[model samples]
Target: MILETFKHFPDFELLDSGNGYRLERWGAYRLARPDPQAIWEHQLADAEWKKADAIFNSKWQVKTSVSQPWPIRFPLPLKAGEAKTGEWSIKLLARLSTFKHTGIFAEQAANWEWLTEQVQNTEFKAQKEQLKILNLFGYTGAATILLAKLGCFVTHVDASKPAITWAKENQIANNLPNDSIRWILDDAAKFVKRELKRGAKYDGILMDPPAFGHAPSGRTWKFAEDFPRLLADCTELLSTNAKFLLVNAYATNSSAIALQNLLEDSIKKTGTLESGELCLKQNSGRLISTGIFGRWSK
Candidate 1:
Protein backbone atom coordinates (compact mmCIF):
# COMPACT_ATOMS: atom_id res chain seq x y z
CA MET A 1 0.00 0.00 0.00
CA ILE A 2 2.15 2.84 -1.25
CA LEU A 3 0.51 6.14 -0.33
CA GLU A 4 1.61 8.78 -2.79
CA THR A 5 1.81 12.04 -0.88
CA PHE A 6 3.49 15.32 -1.74
CA LYS A 7 5.60 16.62 1.13
CA HIS A 8 8.36 18.34 -0.82
CA PHE A 9 6.40 21.01 -2.61
CA PRO A 10 8.17 24.27 -1.78
CA ASP A 11 5.32 26.50 -2.85
CA PHE A 12 2.49 24.47 -1.36
CA GLU A 13 1.57 23.18 2.10
CA LEU A 14 -1.36 21.68 3.90
CA LEU A 15 -1.13 23.86 6.96
CA ASP A 16 -4.15 22.45 8.73
CA SER A 17 -7.25 20.44 7.97
CA GLY A 18 -10.36 19.32 9.86
CA ASN A 19 -14.09 19.92 10.28
CA GLY A 20 -14.85 19.41 6.60
CA TYR A 21 -12.42 22.23 5.73
CA ARG A 22 -8.73 22.70 5.06
CA LEU A 23 -6.34 25.56 5.51
CA GLU A 24 -3.52 25.64 3.03
CA ARG A 25 -0.71 27.84 1.86
CA TRP A 26 -0.24 28.25 -1.86
CA GLY A 27 2.99 30.16 -2.30
CA ALA A 28 2.55 33.24 -0.12
CA TYR A 29 -1.21 33.21 0.26
CA ARG A 30 -3.19 31.20 2.77
CA LEU A 31 -6.60 29.88 1.77
CA ALA A 32 -9.38 27.95 3.42
CA ARG A 33 -11.29 25.51 1.28
CA PRO A 34 -13.83 22.76 1.85
CA ASP A 35 -12.62 19.17 1.96
CA PRO A 36 -15.15 16.51 2.67
CA GLN A 37 -12.39 14.10 3.67
CA ALA A 38 -11.36 16.28 6.59
CA ILE A 39 -14.04 14.84 8.79
CA TRP A 40 -12.14 15.17 12.02
CA GLU A 41 -11.80 18.07 14.45
CA HIS A 42 -9.66 21.08 13.77
CA GLN A 43 -6.24 20.86 15.35
CA LEU A 44 -5.23 24.45 14.67
CA ALA A 45 -6.61 27.33 16.64
CA ASP A 46 -9.36 29.57 15.30
CA ALA A 47 -6.89 32.41 14.97
CA GLU A 48 -4.71 30.24 12.77
CA TRP A 49 -7.56 29.37 10.45
CA LYS A 50 -8.54 33.02 10.27
CA LYS A 51 -5.13 33.80 8.81
CA ALA A 52 -6.34 32.68 5.41
CA ASP A 53 -6.43 35.42 2.80
CA ALA A 54 -9.55 33.89 1.30
CA ILE A 55 -12.15 31.26 2.11
CA PHE A 56 -14.51 29.38 -0.12
CA ASN A 57 -17.98 29.34 1.38
CA SER A 58 -20.66 26.72 1.02
CA LYS A 59 -22.40 28.74 -1.68
CA TRP A 60 -19.38 28.42 -4.00
CA GLN A 61 -18.45 32.03 -3.32
CA VAL A 62 -15.00 33.22 -2.37
CA LYS A 63 -14.65 35.60 0.54
CA THR A 64 -11.33 37.26 0.19
CA SER A 65 -9.51 39.54 2.55
CA VAL A 66 -7.29 40.85 -0.19
CA SER A 67 -7.26 41.45 -3.95
CA GLN A 68 -6.96 38.24 -5.93
CA PRO A 69 -5.03 36.90 -8.93
CA TRP A 70 -1.63 36.81 -7.33
CA PRO A 71 1.58 35.24 -8.56
CA ILE A 72 3.29 32.13 -7.15
CA ARG A 73 6.60 30.50 -8.00
CA PHE A 74 7.41 26.80 -7.68
CA PRO A 75 10.99 25.59 -7.57
CA LEU A 76 11.66 22.80 -10.05
CA PRO A 77 14.00 19.84 -9.95
CA LEU A 78 17.61 20.01 -11.16
CA LYS A 79 16.75 18.19 -14.39
CA ALA A 80 14.22 20.89 -15.16
CA GLY A 81 16.92 23.51 -14.52
CA GLU A 82 19.44 22.15 -17.02
CA ALA A 83 17.85 24.23 -19.78
CA LYS A 84 17.55 27.29 -17.56
CA THR A 85 19.98 29.05 -15.20
CA GLY A 86 20.57 25.95 -13.06
CA GLU A 87 17.63 27.05 -10.88
CA TRP A 88 14.45 26.32 -12.76
CA SER A 89 11.15 27.73 -11.60
CA ILE A 90 7.51 27.75 -12.64
CA LYS A 91 5.21 30.74 -12.26
CA LEU A 92 1.47 30.37 -11.70
CA LEU A 93 -1.42 32.78 -11.37
CA ALA A 94 -3.43 31.89 -8.29
CA ARG A 95 -6.98 32.97 -7.71
CA LEU A 96 -10.06 31.62 -6.05
CA SER A 97 -12.13 29.63 -8.49
CA THR A 98 -15.81 28.85 -8.22
CA PHE A 99 -14.90 25.20 -7.88
CA LYS A 100 -12.71 25.83 -4.84
CA HIS A 101 -9.55 25.05 -6.78
CA THR A 102 -6.33 27.07 -6.80
CA GLY A 103 -5.41 26.30 -10.41
CA ILE A 104 -3.08 23.53 -9.25
CA PHE A 105 -3.12 20.14 -7.54
CA ALA A 106 -0.27 19.99 -5.08
CA GLU A 107 -0.59 16.24 -4.59
CA GLN A 108 0.22 15.67 -8.25
CA ALA A 109 3.62 17.13 -7.58
CA ALA A 110 4.70 13.64 -6.55
CA ASN A 111 3.60 12.30 -9.91
CA TRP A 112 5.46 15.07 -11.68
CA GLU A 113 8.63 14.15 -9.86
CA TRP A 114 8.16 10.50 -10.79
CA LEU A 115 7.53 11.34 -14.43
CA THR A 116 10.61 13.54 -14.57
CA GLU A 117 12.80 10.81 -13.19
CA GLN A 118 11.43 8.27 -15.66
CA VAL A 119 12.25 10.47 -18.65
CA GLN A 120 15.58 11.60 -17.29
CA ASN A 121 16.88 8.16 -16.49
CA THR A 122 20.20 7.37 -18.14
CA GLU A 123 18.84 4.42 -20.09
CA PHE A 124 16.02 6.46 -21.55
CA LYS A 125 18.32 9.36 -22.39
CA ALA A 126 20.97 7.06 -23.85
CA GLN A 127 18.47 5.89 -26.44
CA LYS A 128 18.44 9.48 -27.77
CA GLU A 129 14.80 9.00 -28.58
CA GLN A 130 12.63 12.00 -28.10
CA LEU A 131 9.67 11.01 -25.94
CA LYS A 132 6.16 12.17 -26.80
CA ILE A 133 3.62 12.61 -23.97
CA LEU A 134 -0.13 13.01 -24.05
CA ASN A 135 -1.88 14.84 -21.21
CA LEU A 136 -5.65 14.49 -21.13
CA PHE A 137 -7.68 16.94 -19.05
CA GLY A 138 -4.41 18.76 -18.47
CA TYR A 139 -5.82 21.68 -16.60
CA THR A 140 -3.42 24.61 -16.10
CA GLY A 141 -0.54 22.70 -17.80
CA ALA A 142 1.61 22.05 -14.77
CA ALA A 143 2.66 18.54 -15.83
CA THR A 144 2.66 19.44 -19.52
CA ILE A 145 4.98 22.38 -18.99
CA LEU A 146 7.30 20.29 -16.83
CA LEU A 147 7.47 17.51 -19.45
CA ALA A 148 8.02 20.01 -22.25
CA LYS A 149 10.73 21.69 -20.23
CA LEU A 150 12.39 18.29 -19.88
CA GLY A 151 12.73 18.18 -23.72
CA CYS A 152 9.73 15.92 -24.42
CA PHE A 153 7.14 16.86 -26.99
CA VAL A 154 3.80 17.19 -25.16
CA THR A 155 0.23 17.19 -26.41
CA HIS A 156 -2.03 18.91 -23.88
CA VAL A 157 -5.76 18.36 -24.30
CA ASP A 158 -8.51 19.98 -22.27
CA ALA A 159 -12.15 20.54 -23.02
CA SER A 160 -12.42 23.94 -21.35
CA LYS A 161 -11.30 26.97 -23.33
CA PRO A 162 -10.60 28.87 -20.14
CA ALA A 163 -8.45 26.04 -18.78
CA ILE A 164 -6.52 25.78 -22.04
CA THR A 165 -5.97 29.53 -22.03
CA TRP A 166 -4.83 29.40 -18.43
CA ALA A 167 -2.40 26.58 -19.23
CA LYS A 168 -1.00 28.58 -22.12
CA GLU A 169 -0.57 31.55 -19.85
CA ASN A 170 1.32 29.38 -17.37
CA GLN A 171 3.55 28.26 -20.22
CA ILE A 172 4.33 31.86 -21.12
CA ALA A 173 4.77 32.81 -17.47
CA ASN A 174 7.45 30.14 -17.18
CA ASN A 175 9.02 31.31 -20.47
CA LEU A 176 8.65 27.84 -21.97
CA PRO A 177 9.20 27.64 -25.73
CA ASN A 178 6.00 28.26 -27.66
CA ASP A 179 6.47 25.08 -29.66
CA SER A 180 7.19 22.90 -26.66
CA ILE A 181 3.53 21.98 -26.21
CA ARG A 182 0.69 21.42 -28.66
CA TRP A 183 -2.49 22.69 -27.09
CA ILE A 184 -5.77 21.01 -28.07
CA LEU A 185 -9.20 22.08 -26.87
CA ASP A 186 -11.52 19.18 -27.54
CA ASP A 187 -13.32 16.32 -25.87
CA ALA A 188 -10.82 13.77 -24.52
CA ALA A 189 -12.49 10.69 -26.02
CA LYS A 190 -12.98 12.31 -29.41
CA PHE A 191 -9.37 13.45 -29.53
CA VAL A 192 -8.09 9.99 -28.64
CA LYS A 193 -10.17 8.45 -31.37
CA ARG A 194 -8.83 10.97 -33.86
CA GLU A 195 -5.26 10.29 -32.82
CA LEU A 196 -5.80 6.53 -33.21
CA LYS A 197 -7.25 7.09 -36.66
CA ARG A 198 -4.18 9.11 -37.64
CA GLY A 199 -1.86 6.36 -36.29
CA ALA A 200 -0.35 8.68 -33.72
CA LYS A 201 1.61 7.34 -30.77
CA TYR A 202 3.04 8.53 -27.45
CA ASP A 203 5.60 7.27 -24.96
CA GLY A 204 3.67 8.44 -21.94
CA ILE A 205 -0.01 9.17 -21.28
CA LEU A 206 -1.67 10.91 -18.30
CA MET A 207 -5.29 11.63 -17.52
CA ASP A 208 -7.26 13.14 -14.61
CA PRO A 209 -10.83 12.76 -15.66
CA PRO A 210 -13.64 14.27 -13.66
CA ALA A 211 -16.33 12.17 -12.01
CA PHE A 212 -18.83 13.92 -14.27
CA GLY A 213 -18.29 16.58 -16.87
CA HIS A 214 -19.55 18.09 -20.09
CA ALA A 215 -17.50 18.75 -23.18
CA PRO A 216 -17.36 22.14 -24.78
CA SER A 217 -20.16 21.01 -27.11
CA GLY A 218 -22.23 19.68 -24.19
CA ARG A 219 -21.24 16.05 -24.67
CA THR A 220 -21.66 14.30 -21.36
CA TRP A 221 -18.74 12.52 -19.69
CA LYS A 222 -19.82 10.17 -16.94
CA PHE A 223 -16.86 8.39 -15.42
CA ALA A 224 -18.58 5.05 -14.87
CA GLU A 225 -19.88 5.05 -18.41
CA ASP A 226 -16.95 6.65 -20.25
CA PHE A 227 -13.69 5.82 -18.42
CA PRO A 228 -13.48 2.21 -19.62
CA ARG A 229 -13.98 3.25 -23.20
CA LEU A 230 -11.49 6.09 -22.89
CA LEU A 231 -8.83 3.84 -21.36
CA ALA A 232 -9.28 1.28 -24.13
CA ASP A 233 -8.90 3.97 -26.76
CA CYS A 234 -5.81 5.39 -25.05
CA THR A 235 -4.17 1.98 -25.05
CA GLU A 236 -4.37 1.95 -28.82
CA LEU A 237 -2.45 5.23 -29.02
CA LEU A 238 0.52 4.09 -26.99
CA SER A 239 3.82 3.78 -28.79
CA THR A 240 5.43 0.37 -29.02
CA ASN A 241 7.99 1.55 -26.49
CA ALA A 242 5.48 3.22 -24.26
CA LYS A 243 6.93 3.97 -20.84
CA PHE A 244 4.01 4.87 -18.65
CA LEU A 245 0.29 5.42 -18.21
CA LEU A 246 -1.14 7.35 -15.22
CA VAL A 247 -4.74 7.76 -14.16
CA ASN A 248 -5.96 10.06 -11.37
CA ALA A 249 -9.48 10.49 -10.09
CA TYR A 250 -10.65 12.88 -7.42
CA ALA A 251 -13.72 12.61 -5.14
CA THR A 252 -15.15 9.71 -7.07
CA ASN A 253 -16.92 6.62 -5.79
CA SER A 254 -14.35 4.48 -7.58
CA SER A 255 -11.55 2.98 -5.50
CA ALA A 256 -7.83 2.79 -6.24
CA ILE A 257 -8.15 -0.94 -6.81
CA ALA A 258 -10.87 -0.22 -9.35
CA LEU A 259 -8.50 2.04 -11.27
CA GLN A 260 -5.82 -0.64 -11.11
CA ASN A 261 -8.25 -3.20 -12.51
CA LEU A 262 -9.26 -0.80 -15.26
CA LEU A 263 -5.66 -0.22 -16.34
CA GLU A 264 -4.71 -3.88 -15.99
CA ASP A 265 -7.62 -4.87 -18.18
CA SER A 266 -7.10 -2.23 -20.83
CA ILE A 267 -3.31 -1.87 -21.31
CA LYS A 268 -2.60 -5.57 -21.99
CA LYS A 269 1.08 -4.87 -21.37
CA THR A 270 3.66 -6.08 -18.88
CA GLY A 271 4.49 -3.34 -16.39
CA THR A 272 4.67 -2.49 -12.69
CA LEU A 273 1.24 -1.39 -11.51
CA GLU A 274 0.95 0.67 -8.32
CA SER A 275 -2.32 1.93 -6.93
CA GLY A 276 -3.13 3.94 -3.80
CA GLU A 277 -4.59 7.09 -2.36
CA LEU A 278 -3.13 10.49 -3.02
CA CYS A 279 -3.04 12.24 0.32
CA LEU A 280 -1.89 15.46 1.93
CA LYS A 281 -0.25 15.39 5.33
CA GLN A 282 -1.74 18.01 7.55
CA ASN A 283 0.19 19.80 10.28
CA SER A 284 -1.36 17.36 12.73
CA GLY A 285 0.56 14.56 11.06
CA ARG A 286 -2.66 13.03 9.79
CA LEU A 287 -2.93 12.11 6.17
CA ILE A 288 -5.98 13.58 4.48
CA SER A 289 -7.01 11.47 1.54
CA THR A 290 -7.79 13.59 -1.49
CA GLY A 291 -7.98 11.22 -4.42
CA ILE A 292 -7.24 7.76 -5.82
CA PHE A 293 -4.67 6.97 -8.50
CA GLY A 294 -3.27 4.06 -10.50
CA ARG A 295 0.09 4.24 -12.25
CA TRP A 296 1.70 1.79 -14.68
CA SER A 297 5.31 1.94 -15.74
CA LYS A 298 7.92 -0.19 -17.41
Candidate 2:
Protein backbone atom coordinates (compact mmCIF):
# COMPACT_ATOMS: atom_id res chain seq x y z
CA MET A 1 0.00 0.00 0.00
CA ILE A 2 2.64 2.49 -0.98
CA LEU A 3 1.03 5.83 -1.92
CA GLU A 4 3.34 7.87 -4.14
CA THR A 5 2.89 11.62 -3.83
CA PHE A 6 4.64 14.41 -5.74
CA LYS A 7 5.08 17.61 -3.73
CA HIS A 8 8.52 18.86 -4.72
CA PHE A 9 7.70 20.23 -8.17
CA PRO A 10 8.38 23.93 -7.82
CA ASP A 11 6.53 24.84 -11.00
CA PHE A 12 3.35 22.97 -10.10
CA GLU A 13 1.08 23.05 -7.05
CA LEU A 14 -2.34 21.77 -6.12
CA LEU A 15 -3.92 24.70 -4.40
CA ASP A 16 -7.32 23.14 -3.70
CA SER A 17 -9.62 20.35 -4.81
CA GLY A 18 -13.27 19.54 -4.18
CA ASN A 19 -16.72 19.35 -5.75
CA GLY A 20 -15.45 17.40 -8.74
CA TYR A 21 -12.67 19.83 -9.61
CA ARG A 22 -9.10 20.78 -8.80
CA LEU A 23 -7.37 24.16 -8.63
CA GLU A 24 -3.75 24.09 -9.64
CA ARG A 25 -0.84 26.36 -10.51
CA TRP A 26 1.41 25.62 -13.47
CA GLY A 27 4.10 28.28 -13.46
CA ALA A 28 2.37 31.63 -12.93
CA TYR A 29 -0.92 30.49 -14.45
CA ARG A 30 -3.66 29.06 -12.28
CA LEU A 31 -6.19 26.61 -13.73
CA ALA A 32 -9.26 24.79 -12.49
CA ARG A 33 -9.96 21.42 -14.07
CA PRO A 34 -12.42 18.61 -13.46
CA ASP A 35 -11.40 15.71 -11.27
CA PRO A 36 -14.02 13.21 -10.25
CA GLN A 37 -11.75 11.94 -7.46
CA ALA A 38 -11.80 15.30 -5.70
CA ILE A 39 -15.14 14.54 -4.08
CA TRP A 40 -14.52 16.18 -0.71
CA GLU A 41 -15.20 19.79 0.20
CA HIS A 42 -12.64 22.38 -0.72
CA GLN A 43 -10.67 24.06 2.06
CA LEU A 44 -9.73 27.19 0.12
CA ALA A 45 -11.94 30.23 0.28
CA ASP A 46 -14.15 31.25 -2.64
CA ALA A 47 -11.89 34.12 -3.49
CA GLU A 48 -8.95 31.77 -3.88
CA TRP A 49 -10.80 29.56 -6.35
CA LYS A 50 -11.99 32.65 -8.18
CA LYS A 51 -8.39 33.69 -8.75
CA ALA A 52 -7.94 30.96 -11.33
CA ASP A 53 -6.67 32.31 -14.63
CA ALA A 54 -8.91 29.84 -16.43
CA ILE A 55 -11.49 27.18 -15.63
CA PHE A 56 -12.61 24.17 -17.65
CA ASN A 57 -16.32 23.67 -17.47
CA SER A 58 -18.40 20.73 -18.57
CA LYS A 59 -18.22 19.77 -22.29
CA TRP A 60 -14.57 20.83 -22.30
CA GLN A 61 -15.37 24.54 -22.39
CA VAL A 62 -12.82 26.93 -20.95
CA LYS A 63 -14.01 30.10 -19.30
CA THR A 64 -11.27 32.70 -19.03
CA SER A 65 -9.26 35.36 -20.84
CA VAL A 66 -5.85 33.93 -20.09
CA SER A 67 -3.16 33.81 -22.73
CA GLN A 68 -2.53 30.63 -24.68
CA PRO A 69 0.65 28.55 -24.55
CA TRP A 70 2.40 29.80 -21.44
CA PRO A 71 5.85 28.55 -20.50
CA ILE A 72 6.73 26.56 -17.33
CA ARG A 73 10.05 25.37 -16.01
CA PHE A 74 11.09 22.40 -13.86
CA PRO A 75 14.43 21.11 -12.63
CA LEU A 76 15.92 18.42 -14.85
CA PRO A 77 18.10 15.47 -13.88
CA LEU A 78 21.53 16.75 -12.78
CA LYS A 79 23.92 17.02 -15.70
CA ALA A 80 27.49 18.23 -16.19
CA GLY A 81 28.87 21.81 -16.39
CA GLU A 82 27.12 25.07 -15.41
CA ALA A 83 23.82 23.76 -16.85
CA LYS A 84 24.15 20.86 -14.40
CA THR A 85 21.79 22.49 -11.92
CA GLY A 86 19.69 24.21 -14.55
CA GLU A 87 16.01 23.57 -15.24
CA TRP A 88 14.04 22.59 -18.37
CA SER A 89 11.08 24.46 -19.79
CA ILE A 90 7.90 23.36 -21.61
CA LYS A 91 5.03 25.25 -23.16
CA LEU A 92 1.52 24.71 -21.79
CA LEU A 93 -1.71 25.46 -23.57
CA ALA A 94 -4.33 25.94 -20.84
CA ARG A 95 -7.24 25.46 -23.15
CA LEU A 96 -10.14 23.11 -22.70
CA SER A 97 -9.71 19.87 -24.59
CA THR A 98 -11.65 16.68 -25.17
CA PHE A 99 -9.75 14.97 -22.36
CA LYS A 100 -9.78 17.97 -20.03
CA HIS A 101 -6.03 17.68 -19.63
CA THR A 102 -3.43 20.47 -19.57
CA GLY A 103 -0.53 18.62 -21.30
CA ILE A 104 1.18 17.65 -18.03
CA PHE A 105 0.39 15.13 -15.32
CA ALA A 106 2.03 16.53 -12.19
CA GLU A 107 1.29 13.35 -10.23
CA GLN A 108 3.85 11.59 -12.42
CA ALA A 109 6.66 13.61 -10.83
CA ALA A 110 6.97 10.76 -8.35
CA ASN A 111 7.64 8.25 -11.13
CA TRP A 112 9.96 10.66 -12.94
CA GLU A 113 12.02 11.06 -9.77
CA TRP A 114 12.16 7.29 -9.27
CA LEU A 115 13.15 6.64 -12.89
CA THR A 116 15.90 9.24 -12.69
CA GLU A 117 17.33 7.71 -9.51
CA GLN A 118 17.28 4.27 -11.11
CA VAL A 119 19.19 5.55 -14.13
CA GLN A 120 21.71 7.49 -12.05
CA ASN A 121 22.47 4.65 -9.63
CA THR A 122 26.17 4.05 -9.11
CA GLU A 123 25.83 0.44 -10.18
CA PHE A 124 24.20 1.46 -13.44
CA LYS A 125 26.96 3.99 -14.13
CA ALA A 126 29.71 1.54 -13.17
CA GLN A 127 28.45 -0.97 -15.71
CA LYS A 128 29.19 1.52 -18.51
CA GLU A 129 26.35 -0.02 -20.52
CA GLN A 130 24.16 2.44 -22.31
CA LEU A 131 20.54 1.72 -21.48
CA LYS A 132 17.79 1.75 -24.04
CA ILE A 133 14.27 2.61 -22.87
CA LEU A 134 10.92 2.22 -24.58
CA ASN A 135 8.07 4.51 -23.60
CA LEU A 136 4.63 3.37 -24.83
CA PHE A 137 1.69 5.69 -24.92
CA GLY A 138 4.18 8.45 -24.15
CA TYR A 139 1.98 11.51 -24.45
CA THR A 140 3.79 14.83 -24.53
CA GLY A 141 7.08 13.06 -23.63
CA ALA A 142 7.52 14.20 -20.05
CA ALA A 143 9.09 10.94 -18.89
CA THR A 144 10.75 10.46 -22.27
CA ILE A 145 12.59 13.76 -21.98
CA LEU A 146 13.66 13.01 -18.43
CA LEU A 147 14.99 9.58 -19.40
CA ALA A 148 16.80 10.98 -22.45
CA LYS A 149 18.36 13.68 -20.28
CA LEU A 150 19.81 10.86 -18.17
CA GLY A 151 21.67 9.66 -21.29
CA CYS A 152 19.36 6.73 -21.99
CA PHE A 153 18.44 6.14 -25.61
CA VAL A 154 14.66 6.48 -25.72
CA THR A 155 12.01 5.26 -28.16
CA HIS A 156 8.74 7.09 -27.54
CA VAL A 157 5.50 5.73 -29.01
CA ASP A 158 2.04 7.23 -29.15
CA ALA A 159 -1.10 6.71 -31.23
CA SER A 160 -1.81 10.37 -31.93
CA LYS A 161 0.17 12.41 -34.41
CA PRO A 162 -0.69 15.58 -32.52
CA ALA A 163 0.69 14.09 -29.32
CA ILE A 164 3.94 13.12 -31.02
CA THR A 165 4.19 16.59 -32.51
CA TRP A 166 3.61 18.23 -29.16
CA ALA A 167 6.15 15.96 -27.51
CA LYS A 168 8.70 16.94 -30.15
CA GLU A 169 7.90 20.58 -29.48
CA ASN A 170 8.56 20.01 -25.78
CA GLN A 171 11.86 18.39 -26.63
CA ILE A 172 12.89 21.43 -28.63
CA ALA A 173 11.64 23.79 -25.92
CA ASN A 174 13.83 22.00 -23.38
CA ASN A 175 16.75 22.30 -25.81
CA LEU A 176 17.25 18.56 -25.81
CA PRO A 177 19.46 17.07 -28.52
CA ASN A 178 17.51 16.47 -31.70
CA ASP A 179 18.47 12.82 -31.67
CA SER A 180 17.71 12.28 -27.99
CA ILE A 181 14.46 10.42 -28.72
CA ARG A 182 12.91 8.43 -31.54
CA TRP A 183 9.25 9.22 -31.94
CA ILE A 184 6.78 6.63 -33.20
CA LEU A 185 3.16 7.39 -33.98
CA ASP A 186 1.36 4.08 -33.75
CA ASP A 187 -0.82 2.05 -31.46
CA ALA A 188 1.06 0.91 -28.37
CA ALA A 189 0.08 -2.74 -28.69
CA LYS A 190 0.88 -2.91 -32.39
CA PHE A 191 4.18 -1.15 -31.89
CA VAL A 192 5.22 -3.56 -29.14
CA LYS A 193 4.27 -6.50 -31.31
CA ARG A 194 6.34 -5.16 -34.19
CA GLU A 195 9.32 -4.62 -31.91
CA LEU A 196 9.02 -8.17 -30.65
CA LYS A 197 8.94 -9.43 -34.21
CA ARG A 198 12.03 -7.41 -35.02
CA GLY A 199 13.81 -8.95 -32.00
CA ALA A 200 14.36 -5.51 -30.53
CA LYS A 201 15.02 -5.29 -26.81
CA TYR A 202 15.08 -2.54 -24.25
CA ASP A 203 16.66 -2.11 -20.82
CA GLY A 204 13.56 -0.44 -19.43
CA ILE A 205 9.89 -0.09 -20.36
CA LEU A 206 7.18 2.39 -19.36
CA MET A 207 3.52 2.40 -20.37
CA ASP A 208 0.56 4.60 -19.48
CA PRO A 209 -2.55 3.19 -21.11
CA PRO A 210 -5.88 4.90 -21.25
CA ALA A 211 -9.07 3.12 -20.18
CA PHE A 212 -10.42 3.37 -23.72
CA GLY A 213 -8.65 4.74 -26.76
CA HIS A 214 -8.56 4.70 -30.54
CA ALA A 215 -5.42 4.00 -32.51
CA PRO A 216 -4.35 6.19 -35.37
CA SER A 217 -5.55 3.51 -37.74
CA GLY A 218 -8.98 3.49 -36.10
CA ARG A 219 -8.33 0.34 -34.09
CA THR A 220 -9.98 0.42 -30.70
CA TRP A 221 -8.13 -0.25 -27.46
CA LYS A 222 -10.04 -1.36 -24.42
CA PHE A 223 -7.91 -1.68 -21.33
CA ALA A 224 -9.81 -4.61 -19.88
CA GLU A 225 -9.48 -6.54 -23.11
CA ASP A 226 -6.04 -5.49 -24.39
CA PHE A 227 -3.85 -4.92 -21.37
CA PRO A 228 -3.06 -8.58 -20.71
CA ARG A 229 -2.12 -9.24 -24.33
CA LEU A 230 -0.05 -6.07 -24.48
CA LEU A 231 1.85 -6.96 -21.30
CA ALA A 232 2.64 -10.42 -22.59
CA ASP A 233 4.11 -9.00 -25.76
CA CYS A 234 6.01 -6.29 -23.90
CA THR A 235 7.69 -8.82 -21.59
CA GLU A 236 9.24 -10.40 -24.66
CA LEU A 237 10.80 -7.07 -25.60
CA LEU A 238 12.66 -6.65 -22.31
CA SER A 239 16.36 -7.38 -22.48
CA THR A 240 17.76 -10.09 -20.25
CA ASN A 241 19.42 -7.42 -18.16
CA ALA A 242 16.31 -5.34 -17.89
CA LYS A 243 16.32 -2.70 -15.17
CA PHE A 244 12.64 -1.82 -14.70
CA LEU A 245 9.08 -1.96 -15.97
CA LEU A 246 6.44 0.62 -15.05
CA VAL A 247 2.72 0.63 -15.85
CA ASN A 248 0.20 3.37 -15.09
CA ALA A 249 -3.57 3.39 -15.51
CA TYR A 250 -6.01 6.23 -15.12
CA ALA A 251 -9.81 6.06 -14.58
CA THR A 252 -9.77 2.31 -14.58
CA ASN A 253 -11.67 -0.03 -12.31
CA SER A 254 -8.56 -2.11 -11.63
CA SER A 255 -6.75 -1.67 -8.33
CA ALA A 256 -3.05 -1.26 -7.70
CA ILE A 257 -2.91 -4.82 -6.42
CA ALA A 258 -4.40 -6.03 -9.68
CA LEU A 259 -1.73 -4.21 -11.65
CA GLN A 260 0.99 -5.72 -9.47
CA ASN A 261 -0.48 -9.20 -9.91
CA LEU A 262 -0.67 -8.84 -13.66
CA LEU A 263 2.96 -7.72 -13.94
CA GLU A 264 4.12 -10.52 -11.69
CA ASP A 265 2.22 -13.13 -13.65
CA SER A 266 3.22 -11.87 -17.08
CA ILE A 267 6.83 -10.74 -16.73
CA LYS A 268 8.19 -14.24 -15.94
CA LYS A 269 11.09 -12.72 -14.04
CA THR A 270 12.15 -12.46 -10.41
CA GLY A 271 12.04 -8.91 -9.16
CA THR A 272 10.46 -6.52 -6.67
CA LEU A 273 6.95 -5.36 -7.54
CA GLU A 274 5.43 -2.29 -5.91
CA SER A 275 2.02 -0.77 -6.59
CA GLY A 276 -0.02 2.12 -5.29
CA GLU A 277 -2.04 5.19 -6.07
CA LEU A 278 -0.32 8.18 -7.63
CA CYS A 279 -1.51 11.24 -5.77
CA LEU A 280 -1.14 15.00 -5.62
CA LYS A 281 -0.87 16.69 -2.23
CA GLN A 282 -3.10 19.71 -1.91
CA ASN A 283 -2.11 22.80 0.01
CA SER A 284 -4.61 21.62 2.62
CA GLY A 285 -2.42 18.56 3.16
CA ARG A 286 -5.00 16.32 1.55
CA LEU A 287 -3.96 13.80 -1.09
CA ILE A 288 -6.01 13.53 -4.28
CA SER A 289 -5.52 10.19 -5.90
CA THR A 290 -5.00 10.61 -9.63
CA GLY A 291 -4.25 7.09 -10.82
CA ILE A 292 -2.86 3.65 -9.95
CA PHE A 293 0.56 2.38 -10.97
CA GLY A 294 2.75 -0.68 -10.64
CA ARG A 295 6.49 -0.98 -11.10
CA TRP A 296 8.94 -3.88 -11.19
CA SER A 297 12.65 -3.39 -10.59
CA LYS A 298 15.56 -5.76 -10.47
Q: What TM-score goes with each of the models?
A: 0.93, 0.92
Query: What pairs collide in candidate 1?
Result: none
- Number of backbone collisions per candidate: 0, 0
RMSD for all candidates, in order, please.
Answer: 2.2, 2.4
Model 2, residue 194: C-alpha shift (Å): 1.0
Off by over 4 Å in 2: 59-65, 77-98, 122-128
Candidate 1's error at 32, in angstroms? 0.9
| Candidate closest to the true structure, highest lDDT | 1
Worst 10 residues of 1 by lDDT: 58-67
Expressed as tens digits, the lDDT of each residue in 1-298 for candidate 2 is 7889864678899999999999998877788888887788889998999888778776544455656566655565553432543345333333344566778888998998888767776255567767899999999888998788778889999999888888887888767888889999999999998898899999899999999999999999999999999988988999998888999999888999999889889988887889999999988789988899999888
Model 1: per-residue Cα lDDT over 1-298, one tens digit each: 5788864677888899889999998877788899887788899899999778778885434445545667776666675335555557667777677678878888888788888777775355667777999999999888898888778889999999999998998888778888889999999999999999999999999999999988989999999999999999998898888899999998778999899888888888897988999888876688888799998888
